[model samples]
Target: MYKNLTITSLLGALTIILGAFGAHALKKQLSVEAMQSFETAVRYQMYHVLVLLVINLYDGFSEKMKRTLTLLFTAGILFFSGSIYLINLFGVSAKSIWFITPLGGLLFIMGWSLLFYKFLKISLQK
Candidate 1:
């Protein structure tokens, strides 16, 4: 839990930094579309990190459950947000890694599905 808290905190900080950098440093340099995409990446990353912070702090979840969700979300952030950053900031062609972005989105969906399943299972057990 502490590990996740630390990781989530760092990701949160990075999200803020990246957001500021996007709004200021890259605003004039990037096309409007690129800027929007970058903002999307930042939003997704920050959103998941916020969820992760809650998960880590909430004692309702077991350590194993927290770990699993963290793994899925962290992987999703890396692949989803990281790919967008690569494309917009580094000029990487989207075609070169066509499968990655979708795969990351799939990971994010899977994480949410797992949470839903866990809650349903718990409620049914009651």
Candidate 2:
């Protein structure tokens, strides 16, 4: 878990660095829509990165929260950021797939919700 956290932190740092580069360097080349998409991806990636950090802090917790958080964090990265990057790279203009981004956000919310529930359950058990 510690190793995973460290790796995730590194990945998050890379995401931030690349996000900045995309904003400053590629701004002129990318259209407004693409830029917006990129920013959206960056925003969600950073959000989940912080979420992972919080999960890492609770290392001694039960297995349920650990699994849920891991899945959610991975989904957020693969779906949320992945979709945006794909749209930007491929210039897909139909926008029907915009739904995926929200789904990813929903997954993130669900992950946090489960974490909250777990903490509540644990606290109440005491």
Candidate 3:
């Protein structure tokens, strides 16, 4: 849990810094559409980072669940946000990689599903 917390906290901080930089530093250079996409990615990344933090807060997460959630969160951060950052920094025509965003979204959904399953198991045991 500590490891997950530490990493997610760092990732969250990075997201905030990058979001600010994107808003102020890159806004002038990027196309409006690219900038919007970048902002959207940052928004979703930050939201999921918080959700991961909450999942870690739960003391009952098994080791498997922890590992799965961590992987999912990492994938979401990399693919979803990373794609947007790249799209803004480079021309969209250069890269044909927009499909990664949905994969990242699926990871985020899986993370939530894992959490729900854990909750259900606990409720049943009680």
Q: What is the Å distance of residue 84 in model 1 from its true position?
A: 0.1
The digit string of per-residue lDDT tens for model 1 on 24-57 reads 9999999999999999999999999999998889
For residue 111, model 2's alpha carbon misses the true position, in angstroms, by: 0.6
Which residue pairs clash within candidate 2?
none
Q: Candidate 3 lDDT, tens digit per residue, 1-126? A: 788889889989998998899989988987888778888989988998888788778778876787788888889888878877776776664258858877777878887787788889999999
Which window of 10 residues has the lowest lDDT sum in candidate 3? 86-95
Q: Check candidate 1 and list the clashing pairs.
A: none
Cα distance off (Å), candidate 3, residue 70: 1.2
Off by over 4 Å in 3: 92-95
- TM for candidate 1 is 0.97
**On residues 1-126, what C-alpha lDDT tens digit does candidate 2 reach at each position?**
776588578869968896988878879989888788798888878878887877877756755666668778868677778788777766665386878777887887788788788889888999
Cα deviation in Å at residue 43, candidate 3? Answer: 0.6
By TM-score rank, best first, the candidates go: 1, 3, 2
TM-scores for all predictions: 0.97, 0.80, 0.87
Task: Give candidate 3's error at residue 124 in angstroms.
Answer: 3.0
TM-score of 2: 0.80
Q: Output the lDDT of residue 120, model 2.
A: 92
Runs in model 1 deviating more than 4 A are none
